[model samples]
Target: MTTVSEAILSRRSIRSFLDKPVPPDLISKIITQAARAPSGGNLQPWYVDIVTEDSHKRLLDLIQTKIASNPTGETKHYDFYPSDLPDKYTNRRRATGAGLYEAMGIAYDDKEARWDAMKLNWAFFGAPVGLFFSIDKFMGKNQWCHLGMLMQNISLLAIENGLATCMQEAWAVYSDTMHEFLNLPEERIFYCGMALGYEDKNAPVNKFITKRENITEFVSFID
Candidate 1:
């Protein structure tokens, strides 16, 4: 049995995946365990819709059509990032992106390659299973934070089960398409989605590893 600490350390945002299918039984276990993640007041404002292969193909086709028309992804009801992020946040985002692109031998000025890579988000990065997470429109900031915890738990659980996943905020670009296909209720709004499956060992994109700041950078002691 894998320990929690082990899962935390091993988990990474795997960008490459095998075409193999993930067994339903293991998928069930990971999600069931992830549901144990704590939520504020136990509100558990989260709904994960495991996509079927047929639906996956349909969504892929929709994304392809959109990309052909507009290389940039769609806009969302809520902003994905701050209009003006502080230096600390901005630097981190840049560093992670640069590292990932560099791993793929894509120069900073390579617009074509960059756009192609961005399209992978719509393709679920080749993962066989895609998960769409939704929450009620009435949910507050606290519930939103809870949803993040749920996402992290699910990602970590996949690691423990020898599976890889990428929690994709990029999927929000297809929110309307996703909502209609998932038949989401009127009150529910799409938060984000994820791609789940076996990692493709040979993909260069998976080699990117962004650095993390030391504990002192953000941690403080009350004493």
Candidate 2:
């Protein structure tokens, strides 16, 4: 039998995708099955919005037009990382970013090329479908963690079904815009987004493999 670990190991944060389409039914199946992910008190304080068809094109067009003049995008306070983030975490982030740029043949000093690459996040990396995740603003940290499990579940299920996904926290910066665009209520907070589709095997950026810390660095055992 194919093990869950097999699916987990095969999954990658795909950056570039082919121009093919993913069937809506498959998308439905993935979302439905991901519900098996557990939550505290089963609060299920998460919400996801799928964008495709005409809506997806409209969203890209809107963002492209907005970015043409205001490249900085809508400004807001984002706490994705801690203000006093330690060097250990920051160093890892820097290394991963450097590796990604290296894989794409982009120099560390090539600011324009790097921006071009980061801008692809808003483009869903050319995936056929984009998914936005949100949580109730009233929820606490535990609920946020629960929402994350939902995201992880969806990614693994995608892998099991021959698709790839990128969980994009970059979208947190555009939560206001996305909220207005999606007509969501003020009681909820748009958290992040995801790009879903088949992987582009030939894309250099998609081939970059991020390094993971050894289990010994995080795991603790007692006698």
Please give each candidate's TM-score: 0.95, 0.96
Candidate 2 Cα errors over 4 Å, as ranges: none
lDDT of 2 by residue, 99-174 (tens): 9999999998899999999999999999989999988888998999988999999999998888899999887777
Best by TM-score: 2
User: Model 1: per-residue lDDT, tens digit, 186-205?
Assistant: 88998788999999889998
Error at 162, model 2, angstroms: 0.8
Which pairs of residues have clashing backbones in candidate 2? none
Query: C-alpha displacement of 52 in model 2, angstroms?
Result: 0.6
Clashing pairs in 1: none
Where is model 1 more than 4 Å wrong at Cα?
Answer: none
For each candidate, the alpha-carbon lDDT, in order, equals 0.87, 0.89
